[model samples]
Target: MLPALSEKELDRLEDLLITYGNDYSVLNLAELNGFFTALASSPNRVNPEQWLPAVAGGKVPKFKKPAHEEAYTALMLRYASQVAEELADDPEHFEPLFEQSEGEEGPTIILEEWCFGYMRGTQVAEWSELPPEQDRLLKAISLHGLEDNFELLDSMSFDEHQACVPLVVEAAQGLYQYQKQHRH
Candidate 1:
């Protein structure tokens, strides 16, 4: 189990998963949800494999390529852990606005809508106002989509982070369309 993560961190991780899963039909829904749930319960290390079925709960979607699924899951968890590590310095002041929708279809809708809002907020708000990791994630999400853009080991900057708002927004919209067309 992992400790609770901020809303921004979770959103960023979701954006990355969505982008990486762009090539696959089912998206990294289970992985993302499981990661968050695990984090909420305990901040211990998260193993993507162990977490997958728990997150998917047997309804896991099959991707066109097995490698894609593995890759997406790995990247999503890796980045999420990275976010948690960076923010660990601030424990008392982190929680972001969260609204978990209900039912089997709830996660899909929540993910799509939240990503959309995150991107929009990044744009309307000042760069300095956004978190450093968020800005980088947004920029990466904007240019290459979060999937292709985020380099797990790379360092991020505040400026690059702030500039990612539009990119994140664009990526979120793309994801929304994908989800809409592939209703669960």
Candidate 2:
């Protein structure tokens, strides 16, 4: 079993991400987790510089702070190992990070950010041959209709999002397996 970064390590990393301004949806550790997870599951390696801007919704962040880079590197190493180990063990337990902060917007907002990152990663990798199920899941994630219907989203319950969690995991696990040999 690949162990997660300890609470202390995670805490420090989380703080680092939180301190970094949310230029992209990539500020919080959860979004970073999304970014790394998408990269690992891609069939080809993607350069960070190529896709970081895409994840930011096409906005080039003015700054690439070293501290943010360090924090991101830490999560990448840890999350990639975790993905490999999890795919080898039980993909059923695989879960993306979707952090919930007090007084924050609904959980769906993070879902959009995570999915947005995931889709951007796939695009950057030029993963052209995703199987149908995985493709369906990817499309589903990218079109959650969060921003399209904000008034309803403001009071949306998380139940719908929770229901899709398994599907997301299954798709991620599938992608991981399909890309495993190419990854390492």
Q: Which candidate number has the best TM-score?
A: 2
Q: Report clash pairs, candidate 2.
A: none
User: What residue runs in model 1 are displaced by over 4 Å at the alpha carbon?
Assistant: 1-46, 97-184
lDDT of 1 by residue, 60-172 (tens): 44667787666556655654565345334443343322334454433311233233333322322222322464344444433432334347313544444434444443433
What's the TM-score of each model vs. the native?
0.32, 0.65
Q: Which segments of candidate 2 are over 4 A away from where they belong?
A: 1-3, 47-76, 100-110, 145-158, 181-184
In the order shown, the candidates' Cα RMSDs to the true structure are: 17.0, 4.9
The clash count of every prediction, one per candidate, is 13, 0
TM-score between candidate 2 and the true structure = 0.65
Q: Model 1, poorest ten-residue lDDT window?
A: 121-130
lDDT (Cα, tens digit) per residue for candidate 2, span 1-184: 4468877877776665555446544565665566667777776776656655554446443546876766656554675566546556765566776655444444442465566556656766777766786667675555542355456445656676556566665666666666776663
Cα error, residue 87 of model 1, in Å, equals 4.8
